[model samples]
Target chain A: MLAEREEQLEALLVEREVEQFLYYEAELLDNRELHEWFDHVADDINYRMPRRLMRENTASVFSERGYYFNEDYGSLKARVERFDSEYAWAERPPTRTRRYVTNVRVTRDDEALAEDELFVEANLLVYLSRGDSEKHTFFSARREDVLRRRGDTFEIADREIRLDQTVLSTDNISIFL
Target chain B: MAAGDKPSVTEQALQDARDSLDEGFFPLEFFHDENLHDLEMERIFGQAWVFIGHESEIPEPGDYARRYIGDDAFIFVRDESGEVNLLFDSCRHRGAQVCRAEQGNTSHFRCPYHGWTYKNDGDAAGIPQKSKAFKNLDREEYGLAHVPRLETYEGLVFASLAEEGPSFEEWLGDFKWYFDVHMKLPEGGMEVIGEPHRWVIDANWKTIADNFNGDSYHTAWAHGSVLDLELGGEETVGHAGTGDSLDRHIHCDGHTTSMRGFEDEDVFLTYPEGVVEDLFTKEDLSDAQWKLARQALSFTGAIFPNFGFLHFGDTTDDPEKDVAPFFTIRKWRPLGPDKMELWSWGLAPKNAPEEFKERMYKMYTSNFGPTGNFEQDDVPIWKGITESANGQFASSQNLQLNYQMGLEWMSEMELDDEWLGPGFAYSENLEEGGMRLFHEQWYEMLAGNDRTDATGTPMNVQEDQ
Candidate 1:
């Protein structure tokens, strides 16, 4: 009974902490605090978003062959560095963005992996407005993340963002989803 | 001007547009005119040998992928007989697309709207409730419509809708040698990594085509951030320099190839030494071609209407790593007058090591992919150009864009005798020769004067010369 009570408390704690961490991460991205957000990523992070195809029901819809971003931490940092440069014309006059992260679901990984590692899945709808138009571009994705507990905080070790659109309607995917 | 004939305003406008090209200027209206877009769909894309897909994409029999020729959808499939077929997506019964998926391995396609089915080779296989619907519905007559001409060169497939045109070979002309240099890999040649990264940009297809054909001048300013990153080798950086003799641009027919040779013979350093040696010995590349390829750092160009390619060597941010070679093939699909869909594919040597392929792909994505620093700058600028062109002041046919760069110097700069590939080779990479050639061909096609025979040679090739 004592072990059962501890298990129940741990589930509650995981729910609370993971949800808060997601919200905090979303806040950082929307607030354009990319450097601070980078701190939330593990050094060996494997962030990737492969191209999605509309295939026959018999065929799998995801392709392992291509990706919009198959980035390691160093490459990700390099991309961020470009955003800060004066010559990054795409974002010179930065666009206003908002990320609405929802449907946070967290589950502990197999015991063989680690006690602190968890698999997290969430839905994201990012709205961006650039230039002088009231029009906004909406990017929706189902994100699968591997989060590992590090001290009091969680760091994303792996993230696979499965985007909803096959042919992205936006002019360019300059912002992360 | 003729008996009982009054030309429409569009025809007059098109003629005026053509005349303006000879004067070193093109009307801004040409970029965003709805009438011209519709005309181009028929005159240029309809007649020209537009790129469909690489042969590697559908290697095995029954493997198929849905592709587009301008706005018309088609199925690019490898048939049971080991021949590539470009079939219109429509079903004969109700005009519904027979193949809905982007790509798959299927022996046949069954239309969802009406259960009409077509074999991979475009033969009509079945019609649902055939006995009840019609008494004598001929299956052979109802087969999917195949493109008039389908051809391949070194694994790159192209199709034409028009009944008559120059053979694909004649259309390629000197560009074939250059294409081979980019495609002739060591073992199995090049293959598409996956489904292309597609996105729509609010710009005319011509705008993007012209940029890719030869717009080295913009690299210094528009891609200043990329230059600042210094991810490319010295040759690429030097090509961006404001020097007259840094690179070369070659124009043939409607095709253009702009290249900047490496500072030293180390251009082959982009590839693994083993791979280079194997390709040089085994591939069908000529001695001159192999020599030029060894010294080349970048090669980018367009094939007539909209197909464009870029093969360049770039280094990673890791200081210890050597420069890696990367290739990208793209099609600027015209969605409308002021909008186009950019379909881009990343390719790598089929026989390269897994690690090398990964590095090449990474290098490609980091620099030229949809989210890459370079493309991020290009798409926005293209959008801006189209937006400005649509404005009241710029929309007027009177305002002209200057295509006058290098027009005066072109006469003085003799063709590079040392370059044995083909076409008119100018020493300077930043020249507008490619753009001029593109517009010249664009005018000929639109004017209905450039028709090709079975050999793919333009009917008026001798006359035009």
Candidate 2:
């Protein structure tokens, strides 16, 4: 009974730490603090959001053919640097966005190659407002992520975002989701 | 402006806009005017040979993809007989779309609204409760309506809704040779990577189309971030200073192609090592054509109405990396006077190594795709132009936007003595000659009499002479 109690406590602690990391990441994105957010990502991070297609039920919808974003750490850094330029007209006025990350589910890898790794899945809804309009573009996606423990925190190692819309209704994907 | 208070666009207003083209001006009213937009739907898009999907998209016998010719929905499908067909998406029964999915491999399409079915070849297959529905219905007459004139040039499919107009070759003219450089890579030829990247933007189709028709002048200022990021190198900044690149615009029959000759003739755009040799000896192209293709660092152009393409070389952020060539095709599908749907596709040579293909796709995504650095900057400006053009203060029919950069130097800047390609080649790449040709063609299509035969020559040719 004492060992069972200890196991329960460990599970709760892991969940709490994962939740806190996610919340902190959300805060960084929401504030458009991309440079700081970059620090929380692992050097070998692979971030990708493939193009979604409307296919028949029997056909696979996840295409390996194209992507909205397929970035490694180096490319992502270049993309982030573009935001600082005055000629980046899309974000010149800056888009005000709020990332609402919810339904965070974390599972410790049982067949783990390393004890410091965890698998995570979360639902993300980003609300973006730009120019002189009250109309906001809502972008929702299911994110599958792999987080690696670092010192006292966690760094995103891989992120594959599956967008809900087949045809994105937004004018441009200027904000990182 | 109040509701219902918008000024009606008259034929005379359109004529005035057309006439203004010669004076290096275009009326702002043409940008977002509703009546002009509606007229363009019937006049330009309807009559012109609008590009659909490429043949590579539906390589299999039963493969089909949904596409658009103007605002009209279409299904580009391959039949059992190995023939490609462009069918109107509307069902014969209730006029509902038969193929709702963007793309799929299907032998038949069944409408959900009503159970009317169509074969991949566009023949009506069956209808639910056929015996009970209509005993006298003629099945032969119920097949999907085929686009009157459909043609393919190097796998690029184009369809004209009109029963008659100029031949596809005539419409393409000398642009065909330049287009070949984009499609025909020596070995296996180019194939689209996947389904196109699509998004809607609040901008006029013509505005974006014209931009692709040799509007290099906007690059240094509008896309300065590209140069600042070092993606375009010092040569790009040089163009901004001396406008030396402005001489590359080649004005053909209602089309414009821009090709900047590199001093290093061996500097082929992004092919892997040894690929250039194979490309040079490719049996498909003539020796002269191969020589011309060898000198180009990049080629970009718009094919009249709305089809635009780019075949250019680019490098990653690492300066040590070699420059790689990538190809992309885009169509500015008009949604409304102030709105358009941008459909863009990335393509690579079919025989390229898997790793090289991946790199080519990445290069395309980073530069020109919807989320691309260049595209992200362009969309906002296009939207800004649309918004500004529609405002009350700018609504004056007399308001003209300048198109006068190279007007004074047209005669002196001609490159006829040195250039080898067809078309009137300019001495610089940053000139407005292509834009002028595009507008002249647009005006002719809008103002000329509608052709009753498919063989009728384009009106711009007659007007030019």
DockQ of each: 0.66, 0.68
Judging by TM-score against the true structure, name the best candidate: 2
Per-residue lDDT of model 2, residues B168-237, tens digit only = 9988877677777667755778888977999887888878877898887787777777777776654532
Residues A118-152, candidate 1, lDDT per residue (tens digit)? 98999999998987778678899999998999999
Badly placed stretches (over 4 Å) of model 1 are A1-6, A58-60, B1-9, B238-246, B317-321, B409-414, B451-465
Q: How much native contact recovery, as a fraction, does model 2 achieve? A: 0.66
- Provide chain B TM-scores across all predictions: 0.90, 0.92
* Model 2 Cα lDDT, one tens digit per residue, A50-120: 99888876343677878988888887887888788788888878888888889988888547535888888
Candidate 2's C-alpha runs over 4 A off are A58-60, A110-113, B1-5, B131-133, B236-247, B279-282, B317-320, B409-412, B450-465
| Cα shift from native, residue A106, model 2 (Å) | 0.9
For candidate 1, the docking band is: medium
Candidate 2 chain B worst ten-residue window by lDDT: B451-460
Error of 1 at B91 (Å): 1.2
Give a tens-digit lDDT track for model 1, residues B1-465: 345322223876777677676566877767776677888898888888888898888989999999999889999999999999999999998899888788889999999987888999999998888998866988899999999999988788989898987889988877787788777735577888877888987788888888977887777677767666665555564445344323788776568888876544757536767667654443577877777777777788888888998888755643335667778898989989789988888888887777777777777777776787678888888887777666556653368888776665333444566767776677766567678677777777777777321123222222234
Score every model by TM-score: 0.92, 0.94
